[model samples]
Target: MKQTTVSERALVLAPRGRDAMVAAAMLAEGGIEAVVCDSLASLIDGLNAGAGFVLVTEEAVATADLRPLSDWLAGQQEWSDLPFVLLTSRGGGLERNPAAARHLEVLGNVTFLERPFHPTTLISLVRSALRGRRRQYEARARLIELRESETRYATLFQTMDEGFCIIRFVDGPHGPLSDYVHVQANPAYERHAGIPNVVGQYVRQMVPDEADGWVDLYRGVLTSGEPIRFERELIATGRHLELSAFRVEPRERSEVAVVFQDVTERKRAEIALRELNETLERRIEAAVAERQAAAEQLHEAQKLETIGQLTGGVAHDVNNLLTPITGALDLLHRRSADHDPRMARLIDGALQSAERARVLVSRLLGFARRQALETRATDICSLLTGVQDLVTSSIGPSISLRVECSQDLPPALIDPNQLELAILNLSVNARDAMLEGGILTIAASHVRVDALEVSGLAAGDYVRIVVSDTGTGMSAETLARAIEPFYSTKEVGKGTGLGLSMVHGLAGQLGGAFTLTSAPGQGTQASLYLPLAPGVAAANGLSSDSTLMEMEPLNILLADDEQLVRIGTAEMLRELGHVVHEAASGAQALNRLIAGEPIDLLITDYMMPGMNGAALAGRVGEINPDLPVLVITGYAGGDLDIGLPQLTKPFRQADLARSLYRLFHTGETLPTDCA
Candidate 1:
């Protein structure tokens, strides 16, 4: 402590002798507690003893090292600059020695008083030193608070996960420029950049790419003093780096602060999703196009079917007109005398040409679904034999036709005429494929299609009739479309494309399965599998004694909307020596029955205006359950879900005669001759 009259208590040191003791005594007499030290060691000891300030003799402590005392005082945290007064020697160079003056600077809060000074001067000097020391203490307190705040910020900066940076612009002697001097950085930034000691380094040293054209991004922020945020793709070594930059505001010159994050995975995922969506969109477009094409094809098929129906109706009417004309002409030829040879010859030639026209018309009606199917429980061997003869005559002498019938073939429930036509169609197709010469084989076998043999087929039985040819085989692509209607490999005018489609349609109508197998160089084979009629007595490939020509007249109820057909059919029935009644529609037929018209048979057209053939049958059954109805139409069994003995249109007088005769004479609807 330094003695002074500035306050109650003070300590003053003039020298290490009597002056120091006098000063201490004066302070004690003045009722002010104080202590004085002559040497640097005593000064430190006095300070340790709870003295607020120290009084020292500058000359006495001139040779002594003040470093230890200063260090020890500084170790007292906040009290490092406690008060002290330096008492100079009376005559020495205490105030003049340059070395001592330099060393005196070590005592930060010490005051100097000349020797021989008054008590008031020493006291005043001591009080002034204490005041200076008090000021230093207040400043030290403020410094401690600042240091704590700095420590808190440094801890946060080091521990944060995001990369943070601060930059500044320094004005040099030459010009003002921007530089990123890192004031603080986190561990994440150091690890991300693979760089150590990032703090205190310039941004140019950390990332050199930013100094290129992208520097404009940073420059804009600085010029406008605005916070800018943007993302850019950066290259770090060979790896792609997606960095986001945010420029801090309040730029002094052309400097900015930015923070960045890695978004590589997110970018890649977005790209992959975009590609997938594009691929899916393309697939959807393709599906839409395909569906549209299929719809168009279906529409075309339906239009063709409708046209066929109209053609079939016209052909039926023409056939009916031609049948009577040709028959009457043949009758006239027979009745004409042999003496009128020229007249007879002309009539004969005309009848022959009319017969050919009738056959062509019948084929046309068949294609149009107006031709009747005479179903029969028949031996397939005989039918195939018959087809072989027909094919041999029609396919020219170059093509050889053969029949390969299994020794014992089961009877199939099929139409004989349709089956023969199907065989002829196959033979013609084969002959066309061969062109020069080829062997056509019409074969039949009793096929018992068990469930295990062919999946989805019934375990009962089927009759497989195969027509194979050693002709030029079809490629896979050609074979795929071979069964489609109007598709053909033949040249124009050589053949109608309806051959195969008709065969397929007929097979389907017969409740049969048709399959075709062909390879590029291995020829073609078509197999037709028909359901075998139950309890049918197997044919021994011999002619049956009973025939349709020997049958009796059936009490036939001929129902047709066409007046010509009704009247002409009745006249034909009267010629056949049978009782015949006529009705226009199914409703009229039912009315005749209500009028008690004895009708043992109901022969009705399938298509009628008010009551269709099927609906009439159902109603007529309610009236006469014992009566057997024979359905006849231009569109019977042509994609309609109706069941009856349907006779197709364009029937001859003989055909109608034979159908009724056979039904009345024989109990079975199918003929004995094999299909």
Candidate 2:
């Protein structure tokens, strides 16, 4: 293939004189390359070999066929405009000679230099010509880069699935931005829009009926420089287009780039649904009212959730504060037998008061559903016999209490501590209703049920406990909203309204249901249904009065964030015959393990600031998997599922020893040494 590669060489043609040779010598002195040709035909051939610019004598081109030279100039690339220096006789500049004008026409960018001119002048002119040629080459390079970039963009534009176009806002007879023309569109445009060859088509021409709407919509986008997403019906084609558009950069161009998808099928479905909904207006109204009620309930739940967070935090701190007080009082009470009779009585009262504070904290935790449940198979009859005294005291002398339970009923799986709290709450509510006096009867019985027999219960045998009052009964309206959290009929200062809610939550937590039935004249009956258990209750191991059992003392590493809680717990552990080591945080505890410290057991606070007990235990597993880890927490429910045994806080010396017994003794309670 014939080709000409452009270079910075000057071509000279002066067949009749030493002009070509002289010019070549002058250019070489000026650090420019030159090629001299003997004839016009040779000059044309040199031009084919790619010269930056040509210097030809008037005599050389005045007599020869100039067609080839003219043709080469005409065939030059758009970026390339070959500069020429025409050497002529004396006084032959463009203004002085008409023939020079003919040479100017032949060489589009021609310069005239007469004979007998100074060499510097000739060099200066030639240098200027060459400088112009260099810029032309630079422009050519830029054009090549632009073309390659366009090639990549075109590939993506053609293959993209989404319909895309570049439209220019054009002013029409109506005013400014009265029309738009699709200057570019992808191949997929027709598949999506059902309009082929949209390029170079006006918006009005394609969908004249909807042109004004489309124009105004896109006009806003172009003016504000804000991208928009909308769906509009193209009325002409009856197709709905979901489109997103943004103004093209260099905003003066008034062009917008649009990406769109045809959502006609989805639009049709929506329209059909709208038509069908017209027949069910009454049902929809009912649904909306129900949803409003649910929303209100959710709003209340959100408020309670906020309160619950604050309550949980307070409970954690209170439990930590109580840890040392309870520990000191417990140790004092155990050694009280040797003290004076009056001092021993004082110690018993302080210990009892601390127990009351502990129960109060548990009640607050229950309201937030953060209290951990310890469910076991419990004899309903026995549990009621134990709690009757507590309930009787709570209701006062005005309410006469009655209790009944079937002797043959099996044990029900439940948390007796929480159940006791719920019983007190119900009895108190019944007492409030009967200001003068009333009978509060609590009865327990077993019943088998199918799914249809209960609202929320599965088909199974359940132990039902009913607390009925002979006081002024509740209206149906009051009964309906009775169990809702924080909904109270009692006057402002009388009740907290969390009692029934907590009871209901307790039943539900143990795979049971709590329901209330009442009428305006009839007294209220609150029923709690508990799932049946497989066997009799295990003797509870959490009693604080249990004596410490003798076992091998452990090299225990204790980690806690609070200094008081840590010191009190460590003292308890040390008194139980264990060698205690303390760390203020879980990270310190983990570091001890990493340093290969001897540790038989790791007792850590669950809510340490950095590297909590669970994380420390996990890291400890990598070092020594057999090491026994017990997580002790004051905060009950949050990130507590670390798959490790946990002992909650506010424990005495006996309780700490009991948890240790579980670790060292395993699956059996050790008898008190009583030494």
Candidate 3:
């Protein structure tokens, strides 16, 4: 297509010979482009050539045929009404002359000037006419842009995934804004909301049972000029929708633009997940009860052995189930780091459920006395103060919690995590015992234990942690068997019967003794007596200060049978500035060591095909006797006498860092019997 170009120059017409030439020269001197036309026919040709405005004398129009000029004026575009400046004699009064008046009517946009006018005045009039013509050209450009914009909007409206609609508020006989009339709707509006041919129809009329609140919601947005986003179930459509609504402006009549998406699938998934967690919790409880029942049939010594075996098997199975769940949730948590707030909350909920399951498994293992303990010197006063808020919240608002610790209390050697769990378990038990409101006190004090003051402990310094509750006191029989597994006086399904037993086992594992004192009328007090750690200051565990230490990166051999575990662990090691070589099996790891792979440290899973971690370490020992080895295991209970430092599976990056720091920074070595 040939494009039309609008000219910026003026067209001059004058029947008097020198008048037209003189006008063109004057426009030229004023920096305006002008062309001289000899007759009406030439003037029409110049108009078709896109002149900005016309300059002509009264004599030119009076002598020329007027029909062609009138036709040209009528044929101009809607946006273009070419300006015409008419020069007349000073006393001529063109209004009284019928011929001149008729010519003026032909030129739709005409400006008159007396012939004796100032040159500046003529230039000013010409400049004003050109400015008006330029505005018309601008209007034409804007119209073109508007047309293209509308085309793009139409395409987006038709193809968008979310439903979109614009509705103007409609007045009823009762009041204004009683309902909204759908003025426009996209294809997705019908598909997602299931309302068809909705344009130009009032909402109440289309959906007769539509909630009045929905109408009021849009009305509120219109009045407040505020946008709202929410999720709701549409009763009419039988679908869950996430809606975002905003007021459309020029709001004489209230109008709203709504964007919505059907989230019924997401809603269903949330419900299914909640139900799955409940089912899993019930299964775990039932399994624990079943194992406890079987152990009751055995002799006292055999029962402990049988329970240990059963606990290990259950722990292994549970760990297998939790491995992928925790791993996948960890990956999901990382992926959703920058996701929307709602998605982040959903991921956090899933992770919490997985963590609860892990805690349940840990409790079971603890009750069986099979869970491993990772003990360190911990300040008793600091640990109590840290968990004060948690303990307070765990007990309802009806109960009061008090924490008291001696200022000079020494550090106790214990596993911080297990001790926290034990204390939390005791607090919950106390809460349950108190039907009404009561006071729960957690206090720590330094005490000296004489001979036989505590079982399996010599005379030395100790920190005594006492958890006392002013709840319903337990009977003598209840107190005597409180530490026995599956022994509970609470109603069925209300208690797992393992809380106290787990706490007792945790105390024993930490080289501490747990004792409960209670009577029929008085409240109960559960005490944990832990030997003080020697040569460790109370500030050591409580201090948050850390300094970055420079250390040389080591060449490490990493082995795991599980691909995901291996990849995750290897990434952690590499992030810590170590060079890692991965092997899928013990045999492969041993082969690498034997092949002189120059491994400074060897980390291998305890269980693998062809040869186990212990066997592989034994072979590596022969190849390089001084090579440091760390064993990683998912097993709940087993002899860790391989004499190598062992870390439990599903450890965090910090855990790996600490282990490496202890092995390298402290110049520690595995026992010589690490084979």
Cα lDDT, model 3, residue 100: 55
Q: List per-prediction Cα lDDT, in the order shown.
A: 0.67, 0.85, 0.80
lDDT per residue (tens digit) for residues 1-675 in model 3: 002567789899987868888888889989999999887888888887779899999888776688988887787766778899988875334664545577568887888887777878889999999899889889878877887899998999899999999999878754877888888899999888887998998878776677486888888899998999999888888888999999888777568999999998898998899999899999999998888866764554475567666876687666655655565655555557686667778877887787677767776777677677667778878788778888988999998999999987778888776788889999999898787989999999998888887766678777899999998889987887787777899999999787887887787777778999998668889999887877573332322222223347989999888777787778767756889999999988888888888889999888777888899889988989999888887665333777888876555455566677677855665333320
Tens digits of per-residue lDDT for model 1, 205-238: 6667654444556556666666656556655432
TM-score of each candidate structure, all chains considered together: 0.57, 0.55, 0.46
How would you encode candidate 2's per-residue C-alpha lDDT over 1-675 as one tens digit per residue? Answer: 012375888888887767778889998998889999998778778877788888888888787778888898898777888899888886657668888877888888988898878889988998999899889888888888888889988998999888999999999877998999999999988988999999999998888877899899999999999999999887778789999999998899999999998999999999888877875886898899999989987987787788778878899999899888888777776677486667778987987898889888887787766888878988888889989998998889878999999879889898788888888899899998888888999999998888877778899889999999988889878887887767899999988887897887788778898889887767889999999889877553345455776679789999998998898888878877889989999888888988989999999988888788889999889989999999988888323777898887788777777778777767764665531
Worst 10 residues of 2 by lDDT: 537-546
The order of the candidates by TM-score, greatest first, is: 1, 2, 3
Higher-TM-score candidate of 1 and 3: 1
Best candidate per TM-score, number?
A: 1
Q: After superposition, how far is residue 461 of candidate 2 from its true place, in Å?
A: 2.6
Q: How accurate is candidate 2 locally (lDDT)?
A: 0.85
Comparison by TM-score, 1 against 2, better one: 1
Question: Candidate 3 has which clashing residue pairs, if any?
Answer: none
